[model samples]
Target: MKNYFWNMLINIKNGQMAKKSVIIGPRKNICESFLKILWNEGFISGYKISPQNTRNLEIFLAYTKNGKPVINSLKFLSKPSQRIYYSSKQIWKIDSSKTFIIFSTNLGLKSITECKKNKIGGEPLIVIN
Candidate 1:
């Protein structure tokens, strides 16, 4: 089985490092919702399913006015080797103006504020700064 999560993030990070305008990768599970969150939060420009290949996704990278990538870094909170979970209350403890944490809750992937708003605890998947 392919690990689309790792593949997706790595592509974005590498693309930003290279200052690419776009990058393509396999579609992640619940990709639409996840990508929508990132898009709405201004982390990414947007993403679309490939016309020739449905399993693939074409991601439009976002940049600053000076031509710098909006995404600074990505931190894995949970991995296949080691999973991590946090309570809704614990979500409040996370403090960062420029960054937000993505968690896999019962409602699928949600950000810190969403998790707290829904009063749900889940595995912290990635911390995108």
Candidate 2:
């Protein structure tokens, strides 16, 4: 999951969006949620479940008018062996305008803003800048 997200961000930043879409593999529920967040945040143009392969998902990366990638950076805050959990009270803004933090809660994967709005929290997953 770590390398997949990191590589996707880097590829998009390195002009892979020119291809219009990128295919990501072998299926994971969390990837779907992350892609949904990217879409909602306008970091991606669009995405869809792959019809050719149920295990694969297609992502449409976004670019600026001058053709620069929309995502600047992605950081994984919690490791499998060293997880970081946060309560709603512990959640704070991490560059609300340019960055977003994803968390895995009992309610499922949610962003910091969403968790704060809903008054719920969980393990912090990744931060994207």
Worst 10 residues of 1 by lDDT: 1-10
Number of the top lDDT candidate = 1
Q: What lDDT does each candidate get? A: 0.84, 0.72
lDDT of 1 at 65: 100
**Candidate 1 lDDT by residue in tens digits, 1-129:** 327777778888899999998888887676666788899899999999899899899999999999988999888879989989888888777784656988888888898888878889899888887
lDDT of 2: 0.72
Off by over 4 Å in 2: 1-21, 93-95
TM-score of each: 0.91, 0.78
**Model 1 segments more than 4 A misplaced:** 96-98
Q: Which 10-residue window of candidate 2 scores lowest in summed lDDT?
A: 17-26
- Model 2, 1-129: lDDT tens digits are 566655554555554535455645435676777778889988788887788887777777877788766776667788778888887777854455556888888888888888888989798877877
Error of 2 at 127 (Å): 0.9
